[model samples]
Target: MGKYTQDAQQLLRLIGGKENIAAVSHCVTRMRFVLNDPSKADVEAIEAMKVVKGSFTQAGQFQVIIGNAVADFYNDFVKVAGVEGVSKDAVKQAAKKNQNVLQKVIAALAEIFAPLIPAIMAAFVLVYLERFFRKISPQVISSVVVPFCSLVLAVMAAHFIVGPIGWKIGSAISSVVYAGITGSFKVVFGAIFGFVYAPLVITGLHHMSNAIDLQLIADYGGTMLWPMIALSNIAQGSAVMGMIILQKKNVAAQEVNVPAGISCYLGVTEPAIFGVNLKYGFPFICGMIGSAISAVVCVMTSTTANAVGVGGIPGILSIQPKYMGSFAICMVIAFVIPMTLTFIVGKKKLSMADRVGAGDSADTVDVSAEAGSISATENTETTELNGDGANTLRAFLTGKVIPLKEVNDGVFSEGVMGDGLAILPENDTLYAPCDGEVTVLMDESRHACGLTLENGMEILLHIGIDTVEMQGDGFEYLVSLNQKVKQGTPLVRFDREKIRTAGHPDVTVCIVTEEGNAKDFEFVTDIHAEAGKTEIVLFN
Candidate 1:
């Protein structure tokens, strides 16, 4: 199944072919398919495929999991099935459509405002325009177009798009949360928030709770929220430290640990949240559980902070000496519990690349440079292999292709005919590009030779720029017209320096005469192209 065609063929056959596929999209790991009838899929066969990692029914779709080479498999699947694809982000959005009533309401609010985004943007632009026009008229500014257009748009946007909807949602959540925190169930709310807050920091929405803490300080002179913030931070920091201890040799993890620790201890948890804890799923949960326990203790002991700052060591400094013992105990509990839990239950040792998620790249260098037509500085000829383990074309020979820019002839340089490789002769030798029949040969001039590859890709080798003008001097052709030649079989030999002395550039250009199929090849004019060696492009 490493063969893309075979993989596609098998996947289609096992899943009841193209007729059963309702929709399909691919992420980094899986080919997500919404099937007409998922029951028709041969789950066992799919898992058994060499390229397939596994298969699953997830989010109301049949998902075929592939590992790092999912992209290659997905492309083949599309070609074999001829189905249009949605993006990974779209797949995620589609998955989110299956939601509960409360989630639907919240999603609906966001969706409602989504269409008004353009109007909101207009309001901002209008304000800028108003400010720009204001300086031109001190008196007319009162009755100016700026005020009517900009300010009105801003007001309308705030009222309809943001103020009512956003304020109402915030107010509702605030009311419920405030009641929970201030009522007899303060301990429950404290624990719940402590367990959830670090996760919220991953989405960068923990700032919302900062407003609650500030309000608590303003109204009741203390916040049940502040204790959780401190506990959560310390716990998160300890969890990262534990991860570092576990995978001491993981450079990426170690690189993140120190900075993330500093950020968490300083009350800015973003670095720790995103860089460390959030990346490792279990470490974060361990931190949360430890945080929950510390939060419960803080709530029971009535620990408080007098001011607003990051609620770790900084917040503790603001606390009175009477509650110092409670704060110290909270810190110790938060740090110790997460450290223990993470060390015990967290993930196994990870590589540095895996720790930082550098292993997953969205836009990889899988495709060849699209410049057989124009390779920035030169022309490159590329042939792609489909990973079928039965490649049609191997390297004809190993040599570098010079950029077409170096070619002096206008017709060859501009690629008016077609795109291909240009090689500067190092040893004044030529070879067949593929298994082909030598259809045309200028045996006398020895400047160029033409062949028809087995796959019908026509090849024209121009030995040097404007070498045809030299007639047959310093050129020697080894093959005759209609002669059969294998790839890498030397076809021409000429004095490269003789052509240079004759005032012609020693750049040899290979062009395809049939059609502009040169675009299909990888244009690697910059790199040295080695015949029978370098694999420049891969395709069907």
Candidate 2:
């Protein structure tokens, strides 16, 4: 018998046996079941099982968390019940059959809106502001005055004034978009609109489409605009797939690329757009070109959607049955062209460094000689320094050393800010590379620090890629700004797990932001080094 056979038999019996289960599947940590009659399952008994950690019902599926052993448990459960397990997608499809009309609508809406939670969280800023106001108010009137003022300000700013202005602007834009998609030169306009739609999503203007789509449905019984939006999403997803092909060897790139691409194809494009395409530049343009071509085809065939359904390949379900054939052709164009163009362009233009989702060009930092002033010289030169005459720089963190060009950040990799070497750090603490006075410390983020060595070589030690967004949460400063420190002094201690959890690389970079009278420097790279002991760079 399998290790989980007995437990699986008990679970299966508690969940109403195979007779009640319509479908079953397992994700990384949970067993998902779609039941023919959910009421037959005993939730309390299932939760009390030794292998079960917790249980809950969401959408239409009953999920039982089994920590890391869900797959084994699911297999045994299926075997004991004399039933075959299904894929997650199959489970989802079966689950939906159990829901009523309202439940189905709610589930669909939840799926559509789940991707927007990050953006919606911006409203929490008002909650934080309210707390601040309460803290500052006198204790006697704090409760009444603070709540009253906050309520009035929030209501006035959001409901009475800003809300109306925003609605009018959105409506005006939506009207223009509505007219363009339905006008005489619609094919031409469709090409332009499809190309720009993804960028509109970036700027939050795409929300205006919901109003336009509903209005069009009310007036004309359908809207052609939504078909193009759906095609655009497929195009972006295709572009991300192409990137995946180009970056197959890069594990980090694949982690973001695969899921983001899948999400995009499923009608949520934010992950692909912000996480990969926009970060790299070319894929986004490639996707846009493909979208433009597909949109032209959509308009030529006069394809229209009954309403905005899933904005992807599944979107065909929402198209008028008569136009499905033509929309299928448009879908083919959307899928094939962007992927082809992205692979071709990425192969020629993207380096190994670029495929890893390099940091934005805007991340360039300028470092200068003055304390607290950050600026880099545009005309810096590189020359080799002989080992005999060189001043050594100790390793800042124990890790595998790599050339700056290999770093997954355009600003540091391309040497736009300064030439540097990066390390895939093995530890969380940063130590002084040499005896120097701290010249620059990022007050807000604390992800980077600058120092002027005793011999005047200005070095910038950056902790990780895009870690500035953490806002000093996982970082603790060991030495203050402008403090003179000897070699090997602990400079900054960071939480590497926190950095990784926040979706950023923990590569530490040591850059020569300014040469400071040193005519030449040599970088020692590719080998693992010990922090504060091994020499990684030399200056002369």
Candidate 3:
């Protein structure tokens, strides 16, 4: 007999012997069991045993905390009960069989949001502590010292105090939302939710739907919510397509509208929503109307999704096999209604001034007067070029140079536009990397611009991730469209602090949108660079 043999025997007897256990597994300090009938297990008796520490039932599994000796206790218990131990996954699958609909929904929600719980809790904790620290600390060093200390304390608070409490609250919220959607008036609820979903995204409340959708899938084997969300994305894209058609004569408007529409169809909607639709009020409303109509159709057909896949045209793959036909019908409604409505409304609403070239209203640069005023002070002689007949591109911002792949935004990180590098900008002013003609400049937001170098390389300077939503609040465009610019010419100036205050990273990216004449290129990264004076990219 082992040290825990007698204790294990007692535990088995108290838990209704071998027949009560469907599957058993142990995780570090706990013995997890899928019970045949959880009520048959005497929880008080189990906790009273010498080896068991405490016990609780969760997600159809009765878990008994055994401290560090759980492995030994588990070994003897399985042998004494004459049952083979199963994998933890097997135990979880068996446990699911014992759960009722409500219990399964909660269990699924908990599992799905488990990864995000710590992050959500930490964000709240940090925000509260940061304000408190800034108010109390000495202003001289508060800018540096207070942030560090607040971060340390916030992490501790999140782990020790807030994490568990926040999880309970999140679970409760998910349950309530789940109940509302699956209630007697589910179809009406679906219509309301679908119509308002885009607005909810703006307020950040749409995150709750992710947890609820997982719960629905766990309980009913699929979710009706996700289908509506996918349809909404399609509607948003279709609206942009209508705008593109209306603005077909305006080259500058097409630059933003075409890409924003394509991105929306591929499941990324922010560009379309913030960059185009919200800027023009009617398109946004038309998309919302289209979404609601399709959502009603979705609920009527009882269409459901196996998972939250792509939220656009390709989202059909995520629908259940039997519901694919119904989902496709909903997709057509989403696409046609929004585009038709937007086109009809835009024809009257959009005027010649609204459809004009973006640069027409831009601050024009007088070549002679601005040439003397905006010249760089740095000496160009210090910068080096490769000896082997290679052309060099200098840094546009003074900062730590990093590979484009390291950027947080997927468009740059994944090289969707082209090869490039990024800078964690220490300063606000963006200078020309080479002598080029300004080819593309955003009018309203002024967050990004494009240049075609004398060497035929097309360079795109994007100020910050998602900064387009700022609507030119802290940005200034110094160069106008088609203007000739020499190396180190001041292009655009931005306020770094304003970008951070708006909850966006200030990593400026420089992309080679077109290789043009260059056959190949290489990026020099992981080093600090001086704007207008440091060579960062070599084209051969």
Candidate 4:
């Protein structure tokens, strides 16, 4: 997948002018274009263009497949269309508009946590791997446990990753009150100062509570550390709340309704934070408060020792019974207070009803403003027969089968997307075996493509197991835009990285007719099993 700057003018011209687009949305790889009429789309023309992976219709949406380069293209599209990026002043105005302290806090949390999902998941898998090895053998557990234990430095990870982000948001807020103070580094130093002061305060409060023989903590054995955590979290959550408000007021118009509220409620914070905005510090504070308060309360109630680690929703789950109620209270308070406040403040500032999702609305935008005359290129390819005599036909789904690795070797316990049946690869450059038009190209460039052949047949070619993340690094495409490729002509060069990466035998090649109309036919080759010769699979 190449990064062609999406000329808003070119794209606008191709999609019958932007007025033709009833609405626009995007998935991992494709832009979902909703048109008032499908005929309004110059499907063949757009397909022939080199930049598009392909196009297809699914669930009433006309999808234009772009590769991993879609984001850059999208930004380019916005630029050509004269669309504006979210502005800082707009955000400041939004924050100053009408938010309470709690709302601001949650906004901060969302910003800090959203970008750190990858790192967080990496840490989580480390924990799971430790548990898995312990289950396998005692010796294995003893050998790897200490190293993994070191990775359980969750607080350190949070501080390093989230703390900086939170401070930046705080500084943005603080600038309104204190003149100057712009750099993230300066804000972070200030936050660190606050954080250091908190612990001492907690100790003092605990001792003061226990005037008789130092019973507040030493005798009564109370750990006030939880409140300190709660306080920190509240601060960050407020920031996140502020960001949401800002984004709502400032980001692109149109509402993206999604099933995010419940997800965020369950502590899946990244979606809302990343999906919404990041400039505010409040949401981050709220999130931190929620986690920290819960953590501290759990410690105080259960007297739990951190032989491993704590915090996060999972940590909240692992709390002992004595502290469970207190921790739950903290969790609820942490999420709800900030979210409610942010929503309310955002609504008031924007002078609009509460928005449910990030701005993914079904309203039409002038796509032509972005995509101009770029669609006028050639697209004459049709469902014509190649020398190989493989007529272009649609592939329909029969049933979802398991990948070879999923059934036996067990590298991955779960099955991947698409019907996981095995098919043979064509012998040569797998060209357009049928007379259909190229309809889609995947972002990963590894698998999942669509072609609408002549005679109303739709074909989907999904490449190997979990190969999407490869992002076009291995595979190479041979055909150019609007070029006629006969059946058995090589379309994509498949690399064997998927199999090699798993340390498995690479004897198998699959040609699965995994989508529309083509599943009516059966597999046509055992020639693929041949030793040392290039093998190809054909279907009728």
Candidate 1, residues 285-336, lDDT tens digits: the string is 8899999999888888888777556566677876656787898999999989
For residue 146, what is the lDDT in candidate 3?
82
Q: For each predicted model, how many residue pairs clash, with residues at least 3 apart or on different chains?
A: 18, 4, 0, 110
| Model 2 lDDT, full chain set | 0.76
- Candidate achieving the largest lDDT: 3
When 1 and 2 are scored with lDDT, the better candidate is: 2
Worst 10 residues of 1 by lDDT: 358-367
Displacement of the residue 264 alpha carbon in candidate 4, Å: 13
How well does each candidate superpose onto the true structure, as a TM-score?
0.37, 0.38, 0.39, 0.26
Those runs of model 4 whose alpha carbons end farther than 4 Å from true positions after fitting are 1-94, 97-420, 423-428, 443-449, 466-471, 481-484, 494-540
Ten-residue stretch with the least lDDT total in model 4 = 357-366
* Cα lDDT, all candidates: 0.63, 0.76, 0.76, 0.40
TM-score of 3: 0.39
Better of 3 and 4 by TM-score: 3
| Residues 466-534, model 2: lDDT tens digits | 888897799877777667777777778899999999998899888786576776778999999888778
Deviation from native of the Cα of residue 468 in model 2, angstroms: 23
RMSD of each: 22.0, 20.4, 25.0, 24.6
Summarize candidate 3's per-residue lDDT along 90-152 as a digit string, tens digits: 998999988789778766655555445546678878998999999999999999978899989
